[model samples]
Target chain A: MQILEFLNTHMDMVYIVILSVLLGVEVISNVPSVLHTPLMSGANAIHGVVIIGAIIIMGKADPSNILTMALGFLAVILGTLNVVGGFVVTDRMLEMFNKKKPGKSKE
Target chain B: MGEYLLEISYLIASVLYILGLKMLSGPKTARKGNLYAAFGMALAILATIFLYVDEEGNKLQNHIWIFGGIAVGSVVGWLAAVRVKMTAMPQMVSIFNGMGGACAALIGLIEFPHYFGHGGSILILLTIFAGLVIGSVSFSGSVVAFAKLNGNMNKDIRLPFYNIINTLFIIAIFAITALLLVGTLTDPMYVYLLALISLAYGVLFVIPIGGADMPVVISLLNSFTGMAAAFGGFLYGNMAMLTGGILVGSAGTILTVVMCNAMNRSLTNVIFGAFGTGGAAVGPGGSGVEKSYKEIGVSDTAVLLNYSQSVVIVPGYGLAVAQAQHVIHELEELLEERGVSVKYAIHPVAGRMPGHMNVLLAESNVEYDKLVEMEDINPEFETTDVVLVVGANDVVNPAAKNDPASPIYGMPILEVEKAKNIIINKRSMNVGYAGIDNELFYHEKNSMLFGDAKSVLVSLVAELKTL
Candidate 1:
């Protein structure tokens, strides 16, 4: 009974999320030509946000319980990894800009 | 009160993402764009923690495991990144993207069960499904892409039943997905089956793509991973999802288009062309062909340029690897001073990535109007007096003309072969990333000046001074 009541109240939020995700998928599929590569490279950088969010969520969880603590600890580790890894990857990608143009002489 | 604060932070992160994307659209501002994206990610993370609420409407307890996990993952990630070589960077990117998909899928798996059966919301189920489909595809597809990039996968593997098997696997995946959704199966056993099927489909998705198309495949898979992460975010009601999803979705779509343009194929053609089937065939070797020209020093090059009606400059990966755009710009300035009409011919997949050549050229302040795409410039090559090819290979190779057995036969080339006189600046006769020998080297109109791309160009610039 409790579960049924909860479902009825949250139905609107559920429908909204689904509709938004579907629309998001459609928009994602039809990206314009000029912005493709930059868009992908940029989005790869944003993936880092997941790591930080996961860390904070775990950090505030109950530490007294071993299972919860373990989950939180794992989250923090993965989160940090994501953050650091993401930055390193982004930096490396940016370094491609530093390459010399072919068929051009160095000063 | 705290939720409102989190919402504000989300708003800030969203703005950063948009700013980052906007800045990335042009070459001069790309560095600033990268930094903006990093800042947005940080904001999203901070906001997520602030808004997290427990079952009793109180703050969650301290989490030690999460911290420990973060510490370990950071160290490992740092070491892996620091030690990776530049030559292996593309493969490393594939591996890292695959890990992201795996992580998202795992999160959905662990979280969904807990939320489900106890009247778990549809949002949770949908998120799980999204994670499962996208994550699984990314994880498997990336592995195959990595294999191709590393030469572990065969460049020309065409079996009779390969396509049939791939079709069957895809069908099975959809069947299982339908069963899971319809509540026909109640056990976790089906979950594992679904994963296996999806994994198989991922591998099949990339196995038939030729080496020439690997870059496009990689970019497309990257978009898939981002979409998966965004879906996961939606399930959790996390602001990060809304921001990250929008950014990734937009970016992925854009990359797919760019990759398609590079090969002169549509996105659908790339995905469905499977088995090394669609692109141009290779041309006959120009071996033993008569060469009419002698190796000329930079002074000779400069003298010839003085009376030339028009000059076309071709840029390739060698430029990007050596970081030589500025020097090229200086050379262009010198030529333009003598009233030489110089235009740059940019092949779609000229460098390691799409727009790589454009980005490098734009960095050196090369005028946007001076850069011409493959289709727009091929016709002009016939009337071109001097076609200077700098560190480029396959895209300009004439083998696409007569060699049906060659890997690049049908693909449109820059028609540098059609020019009156061709000056190729290269270090050696070595093959390109596609591992095919160029027939353009032995053509009668072609002259090979072997040396480092940057050094040769510099020498040519110095020689121009005497003219």
Candidate 2:
């Protein structure tokens, strides 16, 4: 929460976010078509940071806030699944692109 | 000192994320890049849990729930990655992406009560509501996409007044969002009601789209998830979250455009509506004549392929369906032994998901260098001795170029007809996923080899040995 206030007060982070979005567009333009699916999955994983945000908000409530806790708990689980599954699957897919060898077909 | 450590780690994590994205551009560096990005996520999670403090300087102590949630989700994700077949990749990607959207929506839901509290910045509340609407839409839309792809639901479901309803629904969402922004809507029910409405709208948003256009849909939903997450970042003022979300949103937008261009469809058409409701017949459509392609025996195809100086193989969803990548790799090597130049022609939208065919071919151990894309391989077909099209249809259709009345008229296609000889393998005359007949199949130089892709390739391998 202090970080949130710190960010709003400083105000520069807002510009940073906007600038980052443009910089990101530049970086993404270079991705090859062969890696596009993995690129989608990889970007999906990055958004999983919402899990941390949910957990922080849940901390402000007392034990009686079941709905908030449940929502936060579920959010954590879903976010983790996205991040872990997305990266692992992308890795597995990339590993399959082994360099083929020269010569006759193996029997 | 502890705070400084936390901030440093986050900075490092962001750098790693950017580095990972950069590394993923090439085939060789992609796996390591994935690892680097995963490590970045892990670091961010660890730092947040251990170092989080409230604005009042209270340290966070909720440990068990967070750890437990992470553990369960990890197991589920791990099992999914290990157990899923390569052919089911599109649905899995959609499902995982849906989870990301769900998390963003939940954040908006959890924070709604506080949004009305005094001193809540109007900007923050607006960002929160953006997350709620976009996140709900993306989550529900992705679920529908998954169900349709998995055959649990019908592939295309159309209703009357699609464009009218879609436009009105979007306008209503904006109106409600504007109302909420003014702080006049006090009841929490309004928020819940908005979420429900948005979810329903999302379902309607996706059902009208045809299965052939799903890869583009999935990529667009991913961008929605990213945009929603960025709203959360704005709510919390977390630079890492904001950076990650913006990166995803921008990248996804670019990919959606790329996929749209590859299919030769405008983004406006893809979004407002396409397919489904139109009474377009799905067939070997409108070539006017009862065209029949020449049928070739396995021995003849083998002889032709054996003596050819150059052969380009075109692969599509059918190749993935039959799991024929390895056999094709074997055929390529066999032909190479006889000194025939062999290469693969990959259509951008070849499989159900973008880049999916490349992954499948890689699984079969096809060399990265041998795989050529449509733009680079189109000219090569003119000089090529033969083009062996495997389980591919709409991509190679000359109708995209010649038939002005065809549904897929303006779409870009592989110039397989330009090759000296074209031999296509298929189990039957059924059209491909686009539900359109391939004119390339009936071209004067084209011949059909009837069989499953795997069986035909296996026999071709055997026949090549004889020559």
Best model per lDDT: 2
Q: Candidate 2 residues B1-467, lDDT tens each?
A: 66677778778888888888777766667778888888998998888888867777776666888888889999999899878888888888889989999899999998877866655666777888899999999999999989988778865777788778888889988888788777677677888888988898889988878646888899999989988888887787776677788778887888888878878887777766455335564443545668777999999999999889999999988898898988999999999988999999998888887788988987877777788998999989889999998988888888888887666778888998889999999999877776777777778999999999999889889888987
The prediction achieving the highest TM-score against the true structure is 2
Off by over 4 Å in 2: A1-10, A98-107, B117-119, B280-288, B463-467
What is the DockQ score, from 0 to 1, of model 1? 0.29
Q: Quick one: how many clashes does candidate 1 have?
A: 39
lDDT scores for all predictions? 0.67, 0.82
Docking class of 2: medium
TM-score of 2: 0.92
List the candidate 1 regions with Cα displacement exceeding 4 Å: A1-36, A52-107, B62-93, B116-123, B150-160, B274-313, B318-344, B358-384, B397-413, B425-443, B448-467
Residue range B1-467, candidate 1, lDDT tens digits: 87777778777776776667666655546557767877877666655555656446765445445445756877887787667655455566666666666665555555555654656555566567767777788879988887877668856455567768878887887777666665776676787777777887888888777645777887788778777767766666665665566456556666666566656567776666552343333223335554444465666677777679899999987776665677888888889988999999988777766565765676577776678888889999999999888888878866666676766666777989888999887777766656666767767788777778788778778878777
